[model samples]
Target: TRHDFGSIPQGQVATAEITVRNTGQGALKIEAVSTSCGCTSARVEPTTIPPGGEGRLLIRYDSGLHPDSGPVRRYIYIASNDPDEPEVEVIITADVQEPTS
Candidate 1:
């Protein structure tokens, strides 16, 4: 899953949702969701997905903690039970800007 939040205010929090689909014939069990830093976090709902079904991954970014004024990129690691691909990487990006007053 990939998401671009465009531009966001410096002190605000940004959120994005990713969908995990089970395209394979077997069940998809999401073991964990992790992020690179504390400023970013992710959670998976309905972690066990049946074949042809989907699950939701909620990602939150604390832009206030990231005081940079340029493009920002974050990565999410998803651990699953898929034989072919046990782990997946999700990218989230945004531009942090000072609030216009």
Candidate 2:
């Protein structure tokens, strides 16, 4: 599973795509996706993903609310049915840019 973020601007909305694949032979049920901060929001595509299949989770961060620092970091909490990896955490990082003249 990988989270890809395209180019984004400051004081704008940045989106992240969280992908999950059922590498195992069993079906995977995603309990939920939580965010570390309120400025960050997340939504899952399908609640369940079949074996050998994949699912997507969308996360958006309100960059406008974040401080105009170098980089903003956040985490995504994932709950799944995979035995070996029931729970997984993903990291998100973005460099906020200042408005130019």
Candidate 3:
């Protein structure tokens, strides 16, 4: 799934959860997950998901590092056994704002 987190204040910790499902007949394996910015971090569970199963990608943002108000985007790459859904890219987006000083 994709998300547009709107906006967050600076120095605030932001997080997003991306859930993926294996709707195919074979097992699903996630090769890697990449972020658009260094201030963002992500982690996946199991690294592999069974057929007809679901998995989650947890992403965290260090707003302290990326302190601004605008649009931001992050991407995650997933690799699976199913040819039809062998590779998938998930997106996360948000706007960061500076915390009132």
Per-residue alpha-carbon lDDT of model 3 for 9-63, expressed as tens digits? Answer: 7677788787777787777777776676788788778788888898888888777
Once model 3 is optimally superposed onto the true structure by TM-score, how far is the C-alpha of residue 90 displaced, in angstroms?
A: 2.1
Name the candidate, 1 or 3, with the larger lDDT value: 1
The collision pairs in model 1 are none
Ranking by lDDT: 1, 2, 3
Better of 1 and 2 by lDDT: 1
Better of 1 and 3 by TM-score: 1
Candidate 1 lDDT over 10-100, as tens digits, reads 9889988878788999889998889988889998889899999988889999899966777898999999999998999999999999878
> What's model 2's lDDT at 3?
53
Best by lDDT: 1
Please give the CA lDDT of all the candidate structures.
Answer: 0.89, 0.76, 0.74
Candidate 2: regions farther than 4 A off? 1-7
Instruction: List CA RMSD, all candidates.
Output: 1.1, 2.0, 1.9
State each candidate's clash count. 0, 0, 1
lDDT of 2 at 77: 87
Q: Which scores higher on TM-score, 2 or 3?
A: 2
How do the predictions measure up, each by TM-score? 0.93, 0.85, 0.81
